[model samples]
Target: MSKHGFFQITQKLFLRDGDKFLVMRDRKSGLGDLPGGRMDEDEFFEDWYLSIKREIREELGANIEIEVNPKPFLIHKHRVNEGNHPCVIIGYHAKLIKGKIEMSDEHDFMEWVDVKKYDPTPLFTEYMLDAVRVYLKEYA
Candidate 1:
């Protein structure tokens, strides 16, 4: 694998429904993470909001409408593919405005977690738990 490149920015959507936030079981890893993906190279809407919005539609279905908070709540940095490439993960808070989730094949399962009380051991990364802590502290 070639390793020469800039950091890949991924937008993680923290979708809130009342007191719970959504998490998806990654098909490849089996660990839970926020619903989102890599940011596309966009010229018009360079911000991650549009990229995440598109991701939500593609992952959750086109019928869903999301209202993403203007600013990102968290920023995490890590290496991808076992250090093959660097990555920067931006976490955003979004509210589901309409439509029910239509799970894509990308993930094996989905869950709504009450981060304040739920155990986070099932999540993929330490950052995932950390994200939850921050979310609960700020939003809850």
Candidate 2:
């Protein structure tokens, strides 16, 4: 990795049900992404699990029950805010324990896509798809 710019650390959820994974269309980028965001400045690194849970509750509503892995499933390096803006994405795998999804204003669209059937190209990054594939091989 190049030390060319500042890093924007974010946690992303890869919520899965059987062969399907939950993805939300970003309002700003008009691209599919996991339902998560940057942790607050005051938040501690030790609270990653709780922080993601809070984020999911806020973005997906309080009615849903999701079980997240205690540790991150994958990490990806990408450029946002154009092409050279450095970002480190920490991805976590989650399973929906109960309740149907309800979208919040943060995202414009939400869908459950079957990894084997869905064409993730152009919609998601290669790193993301690779991670999901690894996850599926392990859990699916």
Q: Please, what is the TM-score per model?
A: 0.82, 0.80
Q: How well does model 1 score by local distance difference test?
A: 0.76
lDDT of each: 0.76, 0.74
Model 2, runs deviating above 4 Å: 1-5, 81-85, 125-140
RMSD of model 1, in Å? 3.7
Best lDDT among the predictions, by candidate number: 1
Q: Candidate 2 lDDT, tens digit per residue, 1-140?
A: 66656676678888888778887777777766788776676665567777787789889999999988878867877555345456777888888889977788878988888866666666666555565556556655
Give per-model CA RMSD.
3.7, 3.2
Against the correct fold, how does model 2 do in TM-score?
Answer: 0.80
- In the range 73-108, model 1's lDDT, one tens digit per residue, is 789775553444677878888888888899898888
For every model shown, the clashing-pair count is 0, 0
